[model samples]
Target: MNIYAHFSSIIARHLAALVAAGELPAGLEGYGFTVEPPRDPSHGDLATNVAMVLAKPAGSNPRAIADKLAGLLRAEPDVTAVDVAGPGFINIRLRDDFIRARVPEILREGTDYGNSALGSGQKFNVEYVSANPTGPMHVGHCRGAVFGDALATLLVKAGYDVTREYYINDAGGQVDVLARSAFLRYREALGEDIGEIPQGFYPGDYLKDVGLALVAVFGRTIRAMDEAEWLPIVREFAIEAMMKMIRDDLLALGIKHDVFFSERSLHTDGRVQDALDALKAKGLIYTGVLEPPKGKTPEDWEPRPQTLFKATEFGDDVDRPVQKSDGSWTYFAGDMAYHYDKIQRGFSHMIDVFGADHGGYVKRMQAVVKALSGGEADLDVKIIQLVKLWKNGEPFKMSKRSGSFVTLRDVVDEVGKGVVRFIMLTRKNDAPLDFDFAKVTEQSRDNPVFYVQYAHARVMSVMRKAAEALPGVDLSDAALAGADLGRLIDGSEIALVKMLAYWPKLIESAAVAHEPHRVAFYLYDLASEFHGLWNKGNEDPSLRFLIDGDKDVTLARLALIRAVAVTVASGLAVLGVEPLDEMH
Candidate 1:
């Protein structure tokens, strides 16, 4: 059970009672407040802002409301004490027995302990790492891939029916360059001496495999066709090959998408025209000339009259064009159709994960979702910042396989997949991250990945020692939960249990915020607490997890540490990371 949510309900009940007793004004049910841990643990266990929230509405000072609320809260069976702090905040300390009861609940649930039902199984779509189908994924795409995957996992844990999607940008000019690059490789494969790769074309030797594959399929016959006939076939073939490479890279990091939506399919199926017609029916489509944007003009900017979408009606800064002067659909038009298709598929909530470079694309895309869905759907875009790679205090080398940038495989190969995934989430999505090759792999407390995993491994080590020290004892979680937990009177032990009890509430907050980095931060803090308690045991034998010839206290301590292990494992699972039983 989520203790914070539990207390929130209790507070709401007391407020309702105050209204019924005529002590406070009516219609105060909608007051916004928070029931969370106090900033200073010594103040109390949990703090609430309800009195401050209801002060103005109740026509009284905050301290007066707090006194009335505190009086009612003190009568609760589980509340040890309640006090008014500062102007009006209520601080509550829960009974030790009440907090200890969560231990069995956690043991019974194991990794499923913190799962929440906040989403109510709503259909949610998360589109991320939709890199172009040109070559292998680079290190630049690694952060978004990991962030999106972790976010999708977090949403699923929050009980949402989520779809992890990847949109293949196969219809853009970049794929045409990929096909031409492969064509050059094909010529070289057939004993034709192709000169240096032309400027503005992909010069990566990675396309050599695509070239050789084409030769294996059609042999010399593909060479007979002209550019027009061969370009389409080559483009299709190249796109497929590149997607396979991209999929393999994702698989190395244990990521797989439910849908690989193609931009080409939207255009080929006439969905692009259908979406524009739908907008026209709503009177949001028009033909007009757009003024040159402020600052520098983009190469594709034009001042001529063109088909446009009335984006300003839905909160975009300005109207955006849907069709260009040459009568071709703009990139924005294809994106609009894609979202229109998503809405038709019954996803009312959508999230897009983009790199920092696409920060400007957020508003326009959100406007498209709002306009197309008639405001029935909502879209959230997360922008991931850049990751700077360093090695031995110097910049890391690039990969020749991916033309000039570091491939995702290079990073994954140097550090294991778990290290790569865990380290990527150590920062907020909008903040810059520095990834050091030596630091991330080091086996020290300074490395968050090792520190958190070591905490779990340390608990497992204690369990192993308990097995040998106290032979023939029932040590399973089920058996330990039935132990006499009243012996857990130590303050440090109770504090650890309280941390475990906070897991469910933490999951809900992180999922709602669309921030998976919070889980990483929480794991580090949890590890520190566990390690600190372990050190205290070395100084005082009474605080040790296993006591000589006292099975009751030993069992209680085992139950406590086991819950810590379960909680750490649960959090790591949410971040798409694995918890190790023993560290090398």
Candidate 2:
């Protein structure tokens, strides 16, 4: 239950009743008001700006309105007291019994405590990690993969029907180059002494397996065909091979997409023509000459009329070309068809997670969705910045062409998948992240993954001890949900409850913003609250979880820590990070 949302509804209903009774002005009913926790906890449990927002509209002083509202609010259940704070804000103090009641509520809910119905089962299409099907995934692809997966999981937790998708750039020139590269390996597999790979060809040894597979499937007869005859077969083979490798890499990180849409599919069965015809019927596609790009216009650049999309009319910076001078479809044209396909599939909400280098293409892609959907759909593109790897403060670089760049598998193998996924989300996707091999594995408070995991592990430890300390009393969630939670009145104990109370509210906001990193930060803060309460016990024996003779307070506190563990696990599951039950 979101306490803030609950109280906002309460305040709204109270004002409506006041308006009907002629105790408050009539027209202030539709005002959007806020009821949130006060910045200073000493003021009250919750605060609202209802009086200040209504004063001028009601033609009365805010303090006068607050006084009347305070009396009415104080009569509400669980509201112990309500007072007019400075200028017109209403500060509300809830009864301690009300605060204590939430502990049992949380224990009863377990990990499902924070699940929300914000999305209401609306379909959401999330496209991410659409790396080319030309090579194996590198460390460069890690952030977007993790971020998109986490965001999809967050949407699911928010009660949306989320489809995780990957778009394969298989129809481009790069795949043809992949075909050529595999052919080199193919010849070598047949005992031809092919020398060093040509400069423009992919030089990675990954295709050697694809080459051997070709030899095994087609044998020496495969080499007898002309370039045109063999290129298609090799290209298809390499695309599948590369896609398999990419899938394996994603699986290593605990990521799996529901759909792997092929760009080539857009070209087949007249789908591309169908998509373009839809745009053309709206007069959005026409033959036109693009103005020279600013500053870096090549000396060879000249005016040439080309088939272009009316991207500018739909909020893009410039009209983008959909077809080249030779009348062949451009890359943007394929993307247009793909997005149109998504709209046709009835996805009203779409999100694309792209690498930082794709930033410039964002506006035009958004324009395509807008134009194709006739403004009936929404598309959000999130760009992830670079991840600079560091070992001992020195920069680490990896490149498959040079066979020196780090692969996603390398990072996962070194620190394990959980560390890699958690660290990727520690920063916003648009911000540059520095991942250190040494630091993430460090068992310290400064390492967030470690700190959060340790919190979960500590909760497990507490549960084990509780089992021994109070053997006669059942510590199951059902029994604990019936605990005398009012026994947990210590300052630190209440503070931890305050943090736990915010979980549902946090999930709602983070889902609305389409940000899973917020969940990561929230988990850290919750862990901090849990850790702080644990540290407090060492100073005061009264704050301890297991009081020798006080079974009631001990059970209540156990329910509190168990809620934290369940909450942390729920949030980590959204980020695809596994919470450790034991640190070692």
On lDDT, the candidate that comes out on top is 1
Tens digits of lDDT, candidate 1, 464-537: 99999988988999998897889999898899888888899889999999999999999999999999899999
Quality of model 1 by C-alpha lDDT? 0.93
TM-score of 2: 0.95
Which ranges of candidate 2 are over 4 A from the true structure?
22-33, 49-68, 83-89, 297-300, 397-404
Clashes by residue pair, model 2: 398-405, 399-405
Per-candidate total of colliding backbone pairs: 0, 2
Per-model TM values vs. the true structure? 0.97, 0.95
lDDT of each: 0.93, 0.89
* lDDT of each residue in 1-584, candidate 2, tens digit only: 77888898888888888889998878886787778789999988999998999988988899998898898899998998898989999999988777777778787787787888889999999999999987778887988999999999989988899999999999999999999999999999998999988988988888889899999999988699999999999999999999999999999999999999999989986678888899999999999898888885678579999999999998999999988999799889899999999999999899999998999999999999999999999999999999989987898654444254678888888889999999999998899999988789889988999999999999999889999887787878788788778788888888888888888878888888988899989999999989998888989888888889888888888888888888898888888987888989
Instruction: lDDT for model 2, please.
Output: 0.89
Error (Å) of candidate 2 at residue 394 is: 1.8
Candidate 1 lDDT at 151 equals 97
